[model samples]
Target: MAFGTVARASKRFQAFDLLATLVVVIRHDGTIVFANSALEDALGTSRRTLEGAALGNFFVDAGTLRTAIDGARTNDFATLRYEAQLRRGTQEPLPVQVTLAQTDRKAELLLEMSPQEQQVRQDREVRLLDQAQANKELIRNLAHEIKNPLGGIRGAAQLLQMEIESRDLIEYTQVIIHEADRLQSLVDRLLAPHRRPHVVGDVNIHEVCERVRSVLLAEFPHDLEVERDFDPSIPEFRGDREQLIQATLNIAHNAAQALAERRAAGDARITFRTRIARQVILNKQWWRLALELHVIDNGPGVPDSIKDRIFYPLVSGREGGTGLGLTLAQTFVQQHHGVIECDSVPGRTDFTILIPLP
Candidate 1:
């Protein structure tokens, strides 16, 4: 029955295409019979090509995978797991937790590959987004507390400055009023993300990218490169156009600032890349499809000293930086049920934003 159906099978493989995990079906002799889209992407090959290929040939520790397959074939274990590095055609070997399972067919097996730390970080992103909501409320309450007293303090200081006789005394009152006004401004910025109304509509991500690109280029105008490497097949998704624009702009603006030296030397470059991600998980929910935008730069990367805490309020890497750009960007993306993550080294930095599609 199985052999008869092979010509017309794959009615159920459609569901596996939507799974985040990479899966491949193996024949008893270790030849791959079927591979899902995720597996095809991980291997960077076509399904037709991967079929009938030796499954063990794609791993650095290929022997272990072959052994697991042999064990599964003999019913030694229903599922055997071993850590192996899956070798991509042109990329580095990927660390994955490999699982081998016996299928209903006597010689058939299923192999699953789950990327190691990437999944852990994604899980933590969900947790952080959960914390993001709490932080949002805290920011709102803190802003209101500071805002209510600011007006009174500034008014009192202004009145005292007028009544003071000594010039030094007037100067002291002026400082008081000036400091109060600064704090008020900070409070206003802290409250901006929460108070802004989300104007939802059909938002073309490329349009947002172009808008930000134009603004950034106009500001710098020379000595820097801003490139677009977009996948045109990424369909339009629902989102707030203005908020996404701000999010992208905030990240790109920071990159431009960090690239000041390189910009002056005519070596700075920032690239905007867009792709469609399948089977993405966000904020404890699963999404079959998502929009991915990468803001990459060739500046000195985020400093290691504060790389982990860069998203926290008032944490600034640059002098005189308000440190609110990334914070606000994260908040805006989180509001749209998306996430933003940063990966940085000395010469390369990537700020990636993921938004789920319906």
Candidate 2:
């Protein structure tokens, strides 16, 4: 009867192993006695290999593993935060956060990760929030100071044109009216995205990207190329459709402009890639899943002097640029509780957007 009871207990342990998130039971001597399915999947190793292996063998850094193990031994339950680089057969090292805990009978450690690919996502969100507030103030002041006077100037030019009888004089007045109208349109474009209503619903990210791509192709036609690499498995997320379209379009337009400048030099390219990342921490809160979209370009890259302030209102890199495109893009993405970040070097520039999924 005792042997039968032991056999039943072992079967129950095996059942629990298959269902848990991650469970690794280690002996007091620091050898792995049992590992669960989750643990095996995370480490990309089989149970047989892990059964007798030392717990520290999996950690990227020996010192961190020793410190965590020592802490767990002294305290009944202990947790240590450290990054472990996991080596899977031929794949690159995967960074993960290892949390070790101990009880009187067994010690268990939880391994999770915030992949480097998703780094700076939360920081981008905070920066976007700040940018949006700054833009609101900027638009209000600019509209009053600049946009209001634009109408008067255009009207004055019309009145002047009527009084001046000479053909040359009238032509000069016409130029003034045309220039004023151009500035008015620029300001309108800057404000249009902001005036859009907040329509919240399920948003298909690919649809947004496709819309941006079609618009960009129409605008640039022969000179530029826009490519897309999307993951159909990504589910619908919550956001405003028009706002996301404008936000993505702004970045793509900037890329097209940058590539145009490099067209005379060599072949230019812009790629839009999307994937899904898990276990991300955005705005100091953990998210189980987040959409990762990257707008990459091969151009001269953003000037270092203006790189840091590119998101600031009225900051522009191109001639005649209002510098509001990126500012508005940042604003709209932040409204969706997402982030947009840029990394530029000589030959490569990437604008990454991270939006949380429902």
Candidate 3:
């Protein structure tokens, strides 16, 4: 019996779908026999559609994958590894690392795809974590340093106002008091994230979405619309209710603000979408399932100038923005051991919060 014939007779392809890495099983002639969910997602299609399709159909530059599969079938190497680009449906081709190996069963060759950008994202995550921790310490000390003297300045200004006979001089003292109060408020926001510890319990993800939706609609009832696309099957998980609310609200509010032009066009929208993710890796740990809450906006995307620094403390993309909203939202989500990521383009921006679910 030929090795290819024996491989075609094997029946364990389903096990490959549970893996986190994108996987595809192919025949000796470059026909795709099976594709795991990860691979299907990469190809932007269903398994049924992917099966029987030519493996080279999805790669713009198929040279590397073609040679790798040939070597895997011929046993040139135990594994053939190379980099290739995967073409998506009407989207940019994705850069990925391809690994090909022969299966124990006959001529069945297994191909694994890992996004090349995953490494870059991981490196960026590490740096962000480090930056976040350092920012926390700086905020704690600076809030105190500014907060302690702020009250004294305000009190002295008030005392000066009381002692001044000239009404014009009294107005100057009032200005001093008002500016001091503004600074005090800013200091309070800087210290906001550290004000409380996690109050964890079973939290219904939908409830959080609804609450934020109501709040946003009440605030922007003119032309803004908050839409919900929820998956009811998503189970309750342990999280801080108030923190989740605040974090989600910050994102939604920012989206609404960005929709100023869209609002004028009478089509501003913010979508609160919840879905379940399986076999996910987050913050360098594996989870069976995770909660994916996406705050999607149909507005001008994040400005390119401050796109990368949007989460940094005191960095605001809008006029009169304190720039503390996203920072606090990130801090709260991090407290729940989740990570938030944003992807933006011209008219769409998605702020996705991933929290591991039990």
Candidate 4:
């Protein structure tokens, strides 16, 4: 009977080893006692190497680990959230999240990591929120200030054209009228998305990519190339179709413009790649499946000065740029519960959009 009981207990222990999340058990004196299989898999290390080593040894900073251990001793479980560099042997340090907990017989630590892509998504969301709010306010004020005077300017130009006897003077009046009409059109474009009704439906991300691809190819027939790498297994998501198209088009347009200079030089390429990232956390919410779409280009990257504030309303690196392209892109994506981010370096630039799966 005792032998059977021991076997059952051992089986349960093995089950825990198999199913447990990444965790490491350590003695009260800070010696590693045991590490679950998940931890081993995550860190690429074995229990033999981890045992008897202080938990702090794995952390880039010794003081942070010590403080967490001290807090755990008093509170039974303590979480310390600071940036740490994780290393195993000669490999480069990896950024990780370290949480320490204390039990009656042993202490345990849990390490989690923030992927580079997800981190960028988060930063982009924050910027988008700020930019959208600012742009909303700006548009409201600008429209009120400009709309009333625009009609008068157009009427005055028409009146001046009728009275002017000289052909050159009439031509100048026509130019004024033309400029006023153009400004009105520009204002309408800026306000059109905001005023239109949102048409929500089930959207296949691949379809959006394909539409953007066709448009981009038609626009830059000889000067550029647009590539696609999609995962067909992903399901359709809930969003506004026209809004998504515009948002995607804005980003793709910027990529095309960036590559224009390179296109003239005979070295230009743009790629659209899509995949599903599992167990992703966005805006402090964990998602089971998030669609990741990457728009990459081979061109001069974003300038360093405006990199951080590229999503801010009216911020642009180009001289004639209105700087509303990315701001509008972010607003539309966020409206559909998505995020857009950019990372750029010399000769390579990547813009990533992540939206939750239905």
Candidate 5:
């Protein structure tokens, strides 16, 4: 193929560059005509290097791709689908589901590669989003139901306390009122997200991080250290500034509390890292660009018992924890069309928030 022809072919397939899945256009002879950006990143090679290379060579078992290509060329199948390990330059081979289809041009074929790990992650994200939506409805309805009787109970207890003459009887009424008030507060928190209107405006993510960092330091000034590694190039986007600040603060505060042992030893540390992820997938949607905000801590990782259910309402790993911090944080981020994920191991815990950017 001439150089001009290859450049035009690549330009025509530029739309594939925005996809998170790796894609390449190959000739009937198995020579790659075009490799998208995602494919380049996965192979740890440049498009210029990938083009004109044999597509079958990138797979662990070259025969598998060769056979698939032959099948496609002969019109033996509408589409060939199989799982294979893909070779890369800088890392271990990645397990990917390969899909091959014929393009309109007789000499060209379209091949897509979806990483198995990424597919699983996308499935999990979908499930998490579904569960979050259901939880929000359940929480809002349940909270309202609890709220109605709670007010009556507190008012009745206050009246009963005033009528009681014996100090012991009065103390019991006071206890009833206190317990009712506590329940009311809990119910209020459960409904808080529903009550607040989503205020949208230009929001600088670094400012949100700075505000949260200030709060974390103020609350744990003695031993905790809050560090920032921000990407100044991240432009402001439309979001609720206060909500983002509160969401970030909640995560940071939770980290600080988890670092109790380390804090006493005067070596507790937390970091706020921000970067731009390209051709990303979040909540099962492909994004050309997204902001990746990570809140990392050096405390003992999340408990094994609650690892999966940490975001569920009323779930907590720490004693005396309200268990609503993460739930609220998730709710706030979701309002901005984003998702929060936690990756934790011994000595390190990272909470990543992904939101699409314009």
Candidate 6:
């Protein structure tokens, strides 16, 4: 693994291979001493070819990288950072954020390149996490406030009905009591996730999917079709089995409802897919391996108007819908340090759930 005058310490650089970012160690003359696995994959080239090549040549504008390398050689600054277009074999040049710094070994410089899109995705995930935390606080406070008055309203209605001598008047009191009871139920559901402790245990994702599938089939036996595309290689991880089942069932049920027209046409289809993702980032943390479970449906997709707001509590596209299904699903998945994303168009809607795996 030796290149130029750099030391043969390939074993020392093995840690970089685990990183999602591309890293390369170069000599003072700008010849690559070592290239990480990430870099090799990004360039669509092997490490053997990358190790001896000039790192600058891989960039769209080599001059920018050359200047940055020269600056690193001198005591110009502790580190240098900039945006650059990286060239790959035949693919379009990729936009990346580049960072250059000197290593302990004076003769070698460490350079890191991360795709700009990846950075944006990480930022989005962080924002989603922050937003979820805020939502939890808001729901807890709001539910408690609603719960106190709700009990009083229902109790008062019950007492009023007992005192009412006129049958018509008693009927009105009954309506009040019934409506209050409904509101109470809604409040309880709003507070349900917070009330229950997250029970963790070994969870086989396939089992979760199968449970949801059987339930869905039983409910829509005549029309809806539930399919499975599971990866046998995915191993079981520690999580709440009940929570996962409920989360998956919520998404699948929503899809089934959305497929109302397709069901009548006898072509409603919902797919449960599972796969393993490697070197993935979720909730601002990196996982060497992650589980990607997708719930895809062939139906009239989520309405474009409310697509973005679908995950928000009490937001629903369907009429008379409580809209808590997707919200609870998102909350349950987040409890496992995962996230759910929805991609919808007119014909296809995909809900992907990603969770870090051991």
Top TM-score: which candidate number?
5
> How well does model 3 score by local distance difference test?
0.86
Please state every model's RMSD to the true fold in angstroms: 3.4, 5.7, 4.9, 5.3, 1.4, 2.0
Q: Sort every candidate by TM-score, greatest first.
A: 5, 6, 1, 4, 3, 2
Best by lDDT: 5
Query: How many residue pairs clash in all the candidates, one count each?
Result: 0, 0, 0, 0, 0, 0
Q: Residue-wise lDDT of candidate 6 within 1-358, one digit each (tens)?
A: 4453333555678889889998999988888888888888888898888877888889899898888878878879779999999898789999999999999998889999889989988887787788778888888899989889888988998998888799999999989988988988998998998889999999999999999999999999999989999999999899999999999999999999999999999999999999998788899788989999999999888988898678788899999999999989999999999999888998899999999999
The residue pairs in collision within model 2 are none
Estimated TM-score for each candidate: 0.83, 0.70, 0.76, 0.77, 0.96, 0.93
- As for lDDT, the candidate ahead, 3 or 4, is 3
**How many angstroms is residue 204 displaced in model 5 relative to the true structure, after the best TM-score fit?**
1.2
Tens digits of per-residue lDDT, candidate 2, 148-262, equal 8899999999999989899999999999999999989878876776677889988999989899999988987777778889999999987899888988899989988888766
Tens-digit lDDT track for model 4 on 196-289? 8888998988899899999998988988988888888989877898888888899989888988788998778889999997655555455667
Model 3, C-alpha of 151: deviation from truth (Å): 3.2
The local lDDT score (0 to 100) that residue 135 gets in candidate 2 is 74
Clashes of 6: 0
Superposed Cα deviation of residue 12, candidate 4 (Å): 14
Between candidates 1 and 2, the lDDT winner: 1
Of 1 and 2, the candidate ahead on TM-score is 1
lDDT of 1 at 313: 74
Q: Better model by TM-score, 1 or 6?
A: 6
Per-model lDDT: 0.86, 0.75, 0.86, 0.74, 0.91, 0.90
* Candidate 6 Cα deviation (angstroms), residue 268: 2.1
State the lDDT at 9 in candidate 6.
Answer: 50
lDDT of 3 by residue, 134-241 (tens): 889999998999987889999999888888799999889989999998998899888877988778899998999999999998988889988889999999988899
After superposition of all CA atoms, the RMSD between model 3 and the true structure is 4.9
Model 6 steric clash pairs: none
